[model samples]
Target: MAEIETLQELYVDELKDLWSANDQMAKALKKILGQATNGKLKDMLQASQDGIAKHTDVLKALIEGQDEKLKKEHCKGMEGLVAEALKHTVEEAPKTGPVLDAAIIAQYQRMTHYGITGFGTVAAFAKALKLDDDATKLEAAVADMHKGDDLMSELAESAVNVEAVKG
Candidate 1:
């Protein structure tokens, strides 16, 4: 990683980091999605994976727009989150039922919140640098992440959590 001496450098670096994060999260989701029991949860996870891919493309475009190399800095932050997500959802996961589904939702939300924060921060940075177009694109990515988070929350509350409580 290059030393970021200016805000623009930091912003581009973050974009690269986010690109890496999205790739990590997407790979993790592909594994986790198969473990999900709830139909809605499965659908949402699949959709979220698609969204992550789309966001990665956007990040790549943003990096190129900044005349930066189309490369990703490994995001240690997301590396940790992905580790925990896999830990709970796959390694130590409960049987394929509501309990496991509930755990999946929790892990998924943790990852999603990380994305929300990272993208929101980049959007702010873009705005601060008067990069209105970049800011707009990043903010849209943030919104899409939030939408997935909301769907997971709804699935948990409306069904998964309730079913888990019965066990």
Candidate 2:
């Protein structure tokens, strides 16, 4: 039989998973930014790296404020997503500009979607546990990041690289 976990325990576990995921994302974005040839893509990757660092600090503070230990559980979901992104980035880099941009867009969207879902779920969990302030702050940050991701998608769709691919 599966053992049931208390709300506090579940919250901690989720936070740990999120922390590990963010760390992995930060590392991946740094690598991608270093290898990226497109100026815009490199800039976006750098911005994401900064955002991930800020998010990690926020999560750490939340955990410590609750008197909880900061420990990370492996986030397999993020690992898989990152592995796929790395594969695509390498495979598509040698292609034409539009195709490369398309691949980058697809990879970035996947990561953003993962972040949106993770943060939303964590916020709900915090709310259920009566961590009201944490929930509000985390939700706001997540929402802003989601908005940024949407704007990036729009930019990618209208970019000259995308148009070149279609030409």
Candidate 3:
């Protein structure tokens, strides 16, 4: 662990944590897609996976631009989130149909909120450090996460939650 004595160091370390979170979520999402019975949910998950890949590459570029190594610190928080998702979506909850879809959407929104907060924090840190370009990129990432969260909410309200109650 790089001893973070300065804000710059802390920012980079936080970026690495976020990087790890994105990668972990991407991997978990592949499994999630299989569990999704709804076509729209499956499609949204696919798009989200693609977005994660793109954002991860952007983060790597930002880190490398700062002359920092593009290494990832394990994101334990996301690990727990993923575990919780699995418990609800796989272990304790229904295996398929609308019920699982609703649970998956709930878990996905929770995870997206984490990304939104993390990216927003990094953007603030970058702004404070006068890294305007990095701040812009991070803010863009935050926007993207917010949009994804909104999409999940729309899907839940329009279909998943209703079907869940009926079925």
Candidate 4:
């Protein structure tokens, strides 16, 4: 990673990091998605994988627009999150039922929240740098992530968590 002396440099670096993070997350989701017991949760996880791919495209375009190399710096922050997610969902996973479903949602949301923060910050950076189009696209990505998070919360509250406790 180059030394980020200006906000523009920082923004570009962040976009690269997010690209790597998205790839890591998408791979992990495939593993986690199969572990999901609830049908709705499984569906959501599938959709999230699709969303991550779309967001990666956006990151690629944004990087190209900035004349940066189409390369991703490994995001250690998301590496840690992914490690924890795998540890919880795969290694120390609960029984393959509502209990595991609940745990999956918790880990997914933690990573999603990280995405929300990263995209939101990048959107702000784009705005500060007078990149209106980039800001709009990034904000849209943030909105998509938030919607996914909300749906997860709803599923957890309405079904998964409830079923978890009934066991």
Per-model TM-score on C-alpha atoms:
0.98, 0.89, 0.97, 0.99
Q: What lDDT tens digits, residue by residue, belong to model 4 across residues 53-136?
A: 999999999999999899998999999999999999999999759999999999999999999999999999999999999999
Error of 2 at 31 (Å): 1.8
Instruction: Report the alpha-carbon TM-score of model 4 versus the true structure.
Output: 0.99
Model 4 alpha-carbon miss at residue 79, Å: 0.5
For 1-167, candidate 2 gives per-residue lDDT tens digits of 12437877777777778898999887777666655656676777778778888888888888887787777878899999989887887644646666665677677779878988988898998999889999997898797688769777876777835665774
Q: Each candidate's root-mean-square deviation in Å? A: 0.7, 2.4, 1.0, 0.6
TM-score order, best first, reads 4, 1, 3, 2
TM-score of 1: 0.98
TM-score of 3: 0.97
| Residue range 49-141, candidate 3, lDDT tens digits | 999998998889989988987799899999988888777876787855999999889888888888898889999999999999999999998
Residue 106, model 1: Cα distance from true site in angstroms: 0.3
Cα lDDT for residue 164, candidate 1: 98
Model 2 TM? 0.89
